[model samples]
Target: MRCPYCGSLDTQVKDSRPTEDSSAIRRRRVCPDCGGRFTTFERVQLRELTVVKRSGRRTPFDRDKLARSIEVALRKRPVEPERVERLINGVVRQLESQGEGEITSEEIGSLVMEALKALDDVAYVRFASVYRNFTEAREFSALLDEISGDGREAAVDEAGGERD
Candidate 1:
């Protein structure tokens, strides 16, 4: 490693430790030439997932993009950042498990909407409004109806399968 202070190429790792969450390594390095010490962090990088749009255009999957959309949806809401991270992680895991090189943008949006639905209703509605392109009240109403219908179906199924 090169020293940032003196730009020396001769450097040795003095100490190494895991970061708070253990997601990365914090390494203390010393430059032998200038005797300058610095800290560096090492993290694992995952392969990019490709997203195929409805227009047949393919783009790389971006976690930041997903997070930004979530932020917009959960604006002025009670959702936590950790919850959003977990939701995004779950979607990424599901996509990776599929072992497919590319996934549709619609599929990705659906995954986010499903996760948001469980986290916050207002957030879910906001996300669905933008994702589903709600240009009219009817469009938003339709989405509400669909969600309500699904909930009613689930309740009925659970009631029928109840024990005792």
Candidate 2:
């Protein structure tokens, strides 16, 4: 490390400590020539992620955008904000675990749908309607059917009886 005051290459690390998040290391350095001290941080750099849009355009991965979409879909629902945040983190983790530089928006949407489905049906439908771009009423009916069918199966299994 170089001394900022005297521009001398005579700096030594005085202290080293891990950051609060444990994602990085914080180092304190002192310039022997000028007796000046400064701090530096070191962190593991991950490869940048690109998000491929539905239109085939590519952009940098954005966590806020993903979170905002989830928030909107879960609005007026029983879902918690922390749940949405965790879902976003889960989607991001899934993409990162692939170790790929670019991922399709469809993959991201699918992860979001899966996460939401495990949370609330209404929220899942809201997200699926926007993510899948549902146009016809039949599409919504199909979604309703899927949701209700799952409920029916669960109820029947619990009852251990045949449907009327």
Candidate 3:
């Protein structure tokens, strides 16, 4: 690993262990040049996956990007970071095991929504608002109703009623 302090390539691993969820290996490393210590978590990638954008653009899958998006949703919520990591790990595993190299953006969004809903309601709505492009407060109401088992169909009809 390159030293973040001095940009040196010589770094020694002092310790290694599996994370709590066993999804990644936690490594403590020290840079010989700058004597800087840092911890890195490494994960095994089953395969290189591609994300198919809605506009027909194909891009390499990014795990950090996925985590950032989820973190934004879980921001200020009571959800634990470990749970978030597990959620992200689960989504990545599911995508890799799908037997296909390319996955639609919609599929990823759906998986995130389902996972967030199970983890926390506020986080789910926060993610849904952006993933689903909620434009008004009523859209949120409809989603909240659906989540709360309060007649989603009726709520949607009322919220989505004539906006003119």
lDDT of 2 at 97: 82
Encode model 3's per-residue lDDT on 1-164: one tens digit a residue. Answer: 89999999999999999999998999999999989999999999999999999889999999999999999999999988889999999999999999899999989998999999999999998988888777789888778878888544644332244232
User: Over the stretch 1-164, how does candidate 2's per-residue lDDT look in tens digits?
Assistant: 77778988979999999865454588999998888999987755466789998789999988779888888888898766656656776777788888899999888888898988998899888988777666666566667776878553321111122233
Off by over 4 Å in 2: 1-45, 150-164
**Taking the candidates one at a time, how many backbone clashes does each contain?**
0, 0, 0
Stronger candidate by TM-score (1 vs 2):
1
TM-score of each: 0.65, 0.63, 0.92
Worst 10 residues of 3 by lDDT: 155-164
Q: For model 1, how does the per-residue alpha-carbon lDDT over 79-129 read when each residue is reduced to its tens digit?
A: 766676677667777776677878999888888889889999889989887
